[model samples]
Target chain A: MQLFRGLSGFSLTPTDAEGRVQADLLGRLLQRIQAAGVDSLGLLGSTGGYAYLALAERQRAVRAAVEAVGGQMPIIVGVGALRTDEALALARDARKAGADGLLLAPVSYTPLTQEEAFQHIAAVAEAGELPLCIYNNPGTTKFIFGEDLIARLALVPNIAAIKMPLPADGDFAGELARLRARTPDGFAIGYSGDWGAAEALLAGGDAWYSVVAGLLPVPALKLLRAAQAGDAAEVRRLDAAFQPLWHLFREFGSFRVMYVIAELLGLCQLEPPRPILPLAGEVRPRVEAALQGL
Target chain B: MQLFRGLSGFSLTPTDAEGRVQADLLGRLLQRIQAAGVDSLGLLGSTGGYAYLALAERQRAVRAAVEAVGGQMPIIVGVGALRTDEALALARDARKAGADGLLLAPVSYTPLTQEEAFQHIAAVAEAGELPLCIYNNPGTTKFIFGEDLIARLALVPNIAAIKMPLPADGDFAGELARLRARTPDGFAIGYSGDWGAAEALLAGGDAWYSVVAGLLPVPALKLLRAAQAGDAAEVRRLDAAFQPLWHLFREFGSFRVMYVIAELLGLCQLEPPRPILPLAGEVRPRVEAALQGL
Candidate 1:
């Protein structure tokens, strides 16, 4: 069965005070997310701080999520790295750890050509044996997969989906339509920018690879359900309610803000890894207010 | 002694047909550039394909250059990586391999905050006793060190210079003046973007970290020497002569064009690492014509 559809909650990698992954905490968080009716779990996604953790810690997190879910929900692991060999190694590790699919982003210090990107995903797909979802978040990765490239990569047998960031101009409907026209049949297209998930899903995007869903799955699911049922009014209400949190995300990146939200909600007690500082100062009251509203 | 002044040639990592680093070829290339009167040798700079090579291979290349140069010219090694710990490791290895200085770029797959960038460089500076030159090529690194961040990083004890990309608008004089006013004295400001090297050097930049210099060192140094001697007429004349090559660099990236030039000159026989296709097809005759003119 395919691993991605509807809401795939991107789980946070909980860590102890010394910044080591706390597998038990991760397991518990996944359990809570599953209980809230989220469709799938995506471990080590950007919101999960996958880029910041070591290989062993990432492997531990993936293993913990798979154990916690116990096949009740599909587990997709983010397996992205700067080097193709490293990404291949991580893909293999994720598959061995029982992940249902791989979320691959073209990570680079030097810019990669479309040919390089295609070959990278093709290699990982050949190596991992699991379905792959190309994660295109150029805001962070600096590698944009244009429609032509996505169409080309879709020819690979194992590349089942793409999780894309919403265009900066907020043209969700137009962008979704363009992608649908370009991509082949059975190739699922999902939206990742949490703020745009409801509109994108309502406008016929296949899934929402969501950050908010990981921490507040019940509400996130409710919003997704509203979109699925074509209740545009309800979707609008939920999107409005989420505006405060979205504001925080727009100001200081979703990764850092998500850590603050998880800690604020008492879902996890881990600081974001070093180099990523915690949310502080004037933004704290606003975040607290948003959490209270939620 | 300072490893950078005038033209610091960004040497290519000569590789065999199988894509393995040919250390002997790399050594000979460095020697030829030294003979051309390049002020210093910058091995493993982006032009060297440092990002593409494995750690041991990078180490071997650095050691080979050090041995070949044999105190004939100072050697600066590029020690940049995705992770902070990995970068620190590479910096230490470069120092151990007898590199005279380190060229550090803030490499990231996930975008880094200014705080993270500063900390990464600070940690490397603490670990690697060799003098460090910050390499600010935002086009590739996806991490820009603004004037404020550059000022703060300059305060780090061992950061001696910066290799800055020429501004996109080609306002070399204006950018150089701005940097000179902000950074402290004794901080050598070098310019990359081979197209702008003559103007950058003439506008008070202390060095030119040049890709063209690595392959066509004789002519590159003549341009630099003219700029250094304040011969504006000669500088303009040389830059005019180099216009055709600059046009190719503008179309494709410097890394790819430089590979074509090096191969055309009979200095090396290596393709630009895979994913970076060699210059061919419609660009071939144009490149051939340019080489002939040079």
Candidate 2:
């Protein structure tokens, strides 16, 4: 199964002002990725704003996405919550809603000890009873995993993959080689930072767990394929085309910028939930221009 | 109003394994703070494990806390949530439950803009219709408040105080002076790092929003009183006795150590919710020793 490999497109979970999951709109979003033939659908990942949605809404999102394109591609649902039991409950909910795998980030209010994180991940992986990806997203989750911890987790049941942040050093080859040497055979390794995906993929990362592909899967897939084919020049051309949007993503946070991209694409007109404002002022036209030649 | 002044003792809201609030145990904890004659009670702050709770559970904690010590001392409730609307709801809930004031940390999943944080705080302040404290805890909230931003928030109606982490340089007097110059008159500026309370209080900070005061109110009160009286020698003596526990708090987060303290004090045996494990092994005897000299 290509469940944890290749280009995994992450879709946003659209919601009204009250934060209710707009299931139909979400279906529309998922359909684009399905038709684009991305390897998997990452429903309710960070881009999906799973952290903002309630459990029922998250389940609603998973159900809607599953019905939209369950068999067409593997559906990896993000099941991260601040509490262990909550994440476990979300894992079960996603599985029952027909999700194919789980993505768990150690979402924290209290900075966790290494032991706490290991126990939490292991317990969730056990209870989830589905293939899982350890979401090493320190930017949002604020829990940095030592390579030792990640290697240890790689040995746990159902813990089949990892989605890493862009390494600060940008030495993707060195990092990938190190991780690959430690993790088990066929344990997928993916990159999530959109700006770094080109290098990560070119360095032979197992997958590109992408935010842009959620909105622009065809172009993103083209870039991914170029990297897979070792066409560094072609990859650079496509990556250059994405540079402006990547700038916007880095500046405004891809979560906020994706909302603008959705509206610009004429796909949906929605704002992120409160405390995360949508981009206003000069950002819109920049987003329009960013999409002009893509 | 002394609502946001002097020593505000924070209390832990005990919960069962499923994250249900133990209202009676919470009330018992609050009564100790009240009986010790602390200036105010900070309910549902970080030590209370507020982030681990559901909105309904958080409201239940506030209502129980207010009922336990409503008129006896000012009850300042922590009303932080990931969503702005959720926080507004919590602010209103705290007010409806008879809380005297509100403390809001810019609790986030996505890192927020300064404008977003300002707008969120303002909206909650307006809706809460009560004095609120900016919980300037970058350590957990991961949202740093700039001096300019703090000055701007000081102008927001009903936003009356701030609870700061210990400054990186440990220059309490200099930081207090700078913030005091920027903020309006009578807007309280306090600190929460228990190890720094003596220095902070002696430096003329308006309050000490204390975690140790939550369970060990009597000794904490003595330390607060000595600092307030400008008795440097007495404050030093009191602070030294607290060194062992403060050492434990720094080594293991105070949230984990508090459970051990509670167990030793014969108050309650409840563990912190999962993902924040209890301190174990040699730590128990160390805690016992810390209390012996105190």
Clashes of 2: 0
What is the TM-score of each predicted model, taking all chains together?
0.91, 0.99
Q: Candidate 1 DockQ category?
A: acceptable
- Calculate candidate 1's fnat: 0.41
lDDT of 2 at A108: 95
Q: Second chain TM-score per prediction?
A: 0.96, 0.99
Runs in model 2 deviating more than 4 A are none
Q: Against the true structure, candidate 2 has what lDDT?
A: 0.93
Give candidate 1 regions above 4 Å deviation.
A14-25, A53-61, A281-285, B14-22, B281-285
Question: What would the per-residue lDDT of candidate 1 be over residues A1-294, giving only the tens digit for each residue?
Answer: 436788999888887644478988889989988898788888899988787677778888888888899588888999987666678789999989888999998877557778778888888888889999999989877887878899888888889899989878888888877877888888898899888887788888889999988888988898988988999999989888999988888788888888878777877656776556676767777888987767
Model 2's TM-score against the true structure: 0.99
Report the C-alpha lDDT of model 1 over B8-126, residue by residue, as the tens digit: 98888987544578988888999999898788998988898888787788888988998899588889989887666678889999888888899998877557889888988888888
Across all candidates, the chain A TM-score values are: 0.96, 0.98
Instruction: Give the least accurate 10-residue stretch of model 1 chain B, judged by summed lDDT.
Output: B272-281
C-alpha lDDT score of every prediction, in listed order: 0.84, 0.93
lDDT of 2 at B9: 93
